[model samples]
Target: MDHTTAETQLLDAADTLFYERGIQAVGMDAIRAASGVSLKRTYQLFPSKEHLVEAVLRRRDLAIRAELEAYTSARTTPTERILAVFDYLYEWFRQPDYRGCAFINSFVELGAGSENVAEIVRTHKRAFADHIAALVAAADLPPARVGQLLILANGAMVTAAIAGSPEPAREAREAAQRLLDEGVPD
Candidate 1:
């Protein structure tokens, strides 16, 4: 396969394995086996396991941002768009392979030992919070709402993952709605 194809395959395989099995537990050989890419090629593309982990996280970050943007953009109003995030979460949590957010998982598994991995996870989360801030701003709400929404969303992810159900999405959405409503002066 070409370099681009090999790189893509490596990221996909690594993302799945790391998210499902934890980054510290998975080895480069496992990535090669899952990706169907040779050890030499894998090393050539990513000199270290940390590099591969960073790449996997970067790829996931881009994918998640694009997906969340797509989900919110489909709505007409700002509030709808804000709530759409939870809707997206609901569907995402329902996936059979769902294991909470990949960045969160990676952060827990690898962040302490790897600055690169930690930075990537932090960058992804900051970007997500910024996205929520933009959506909240469109509704004429204060920027502080961004932090509130982010906490709610992240809480839903963990709660749903632990409970093995998507119901947290609805509860989070309702809480988010209440927060949004309270922001209004009436």
Candidate 2:
């Protein structure tokens, strides 16, 4: 395969392994074997395992952002778009291979002092929150309320991932509906 394809494959493999297992638990050899690429090639693409882990997280963030954008685009109303976010996440949680949030898992695995990984995780999280904030703004909610709603949505995702159940997403959706109704009066 070409260089781009090879790198993509390596990222894909790393994403799966790192998400299912943990960054610390998964080694370069495992990524090479799983990607069907040589160790030399993997090293050439990433230079270090930490870099590879970051690539995996970046790829996942891109994919999820695309999914969320597509989900929001199909609906006419902002409320539908807001509800769609939670609905999409609930479906994601049902995936057979789902093992909770990869970034959260990596954070737990890498511990608190790993600034590099923490930076990547924080960037991805801020992007998600920003997306929610934009959506809330478009819906015309007050700025303070929009920020509060964004926190609630993000907290719901993390809670669901940690709880290993969809209940949090469901309840969060209900709570979100209540908040929106109170704020926007739909």
Candidate 3:
């Protein structure tokens, strides 16, 4: 296969394997096997497992940001837009294979040892916080509310994953609505 196709295949395989299992648990050999790409080709495309993990994270970041944009943009009001984030989480948490946020998972697994992994996770989280900030500002809510919403959303992600239930998203959404209600003028 061509370079681009092979790279994509390797990335897709790596992303799935890492997310489902973990960065340390899944070796380069497994990624090569799952991608159906030869070991030499996988190494040629990624150079190292670190490079491959970074690529998979970067790819996932782009996809998740795009999905968040689409989900929030579809709402009619600022409150709806903000609440939609939790709604999105609810759907995601409901997925049969849902484990949790990949960024958080990766960070927990490698943050202390790998600066690259930690930085990637931090950047992804910062982007998510920025998104929440924009939504809060658009709603004319207090700036401090940005942190509140972020905490709620993040807490729900972890909670739902641990409990193996989507209810945390619903609970978070309800709390978010209250936060908006307190600030909003009707």
Candidate 4:
């Protein structure tokens, strides 16, 4: 396979395996097997497993940003756009393969030991928060609404994953609506 094809396969395989199984539990051999890329070529493409993990996360970060934009941009009102983020989360949680946020999962599993992984997770999270802040601003909501909505969205992710139900998204949406109506207090 060409270099680009091989690299894409490797990233796709690693992302799947890492998300399905924890990062430490998966081996380079599994990525090689899943990607059908020779082990040597895999190593050549990604000098270390850490390199591959970083690449996979970076790609996922871009994907998630694009997806969030797609979800939020489709709504008419700024408030509706903000609420659509929860709608997106609801659909994401409904996926059969849904696990918790990949960034959070990676942070919990590898953040402490691997600064690279931790930084990647932190960057993704910061970008997500920035996105939320922009949405709150557009809605003419208080700056405090950013933190409130972030908590609701993130809490819903953990809650939905543990409870194995998408109901948390719905609950979060209701709570978000209340916050929008009631406004954040100082």
Residue by residue across 1-186, what tens digits does model 2's lDDT show?
A: 789999988998998888787788888999999999999888889999988987888888888899988988798998878877878778887777777788777787774867888888888888888888888888887666666666666677688777888777778788778877887544
Comparing 2 with 3 on lDDT, the higher-scoring candidate is 3
Candidate 1 residue lDDT tens string, 98-162 = 99888888888878888888999899999999899899999899788898899999999999999
The residue pairs found clashing in candidate 1 are: none
Q: Give me candidate 3's TM-score against the actual structure.
A: 0.97
The lDDT of model 1 is 0.92
Q: Tens digit of lDDT per residue, candidate 4, span 58-109?
A: 9999999999998899999999988999999999999998888998998998
Residue 82 of model 3, lDDT score: 95
Highest-scoring model, lDDT: 4
Query: What TM-score would you give candidate 1 relative to the actual structure?
Result: 0.96
Clashing pairs in 2: none
TM-score of each: 0.96, 0.90, 0.97, 0.97
- Residue-wise lDDT of candidate 3 within 1-186, one digit each (tens)? 999999999999999999899899999999989999999999888899999988999999999999999999999998899999999999999999898999999889889988998999999999999999999898889888899999999999899889999999999999999998899445
Local distance difference test values of all predictions, in order? 0.92, 0.81, 0.92, 0.93
Q: Candidate order by TM-score, highest to lowest?
A: 4, 3, 1, 2
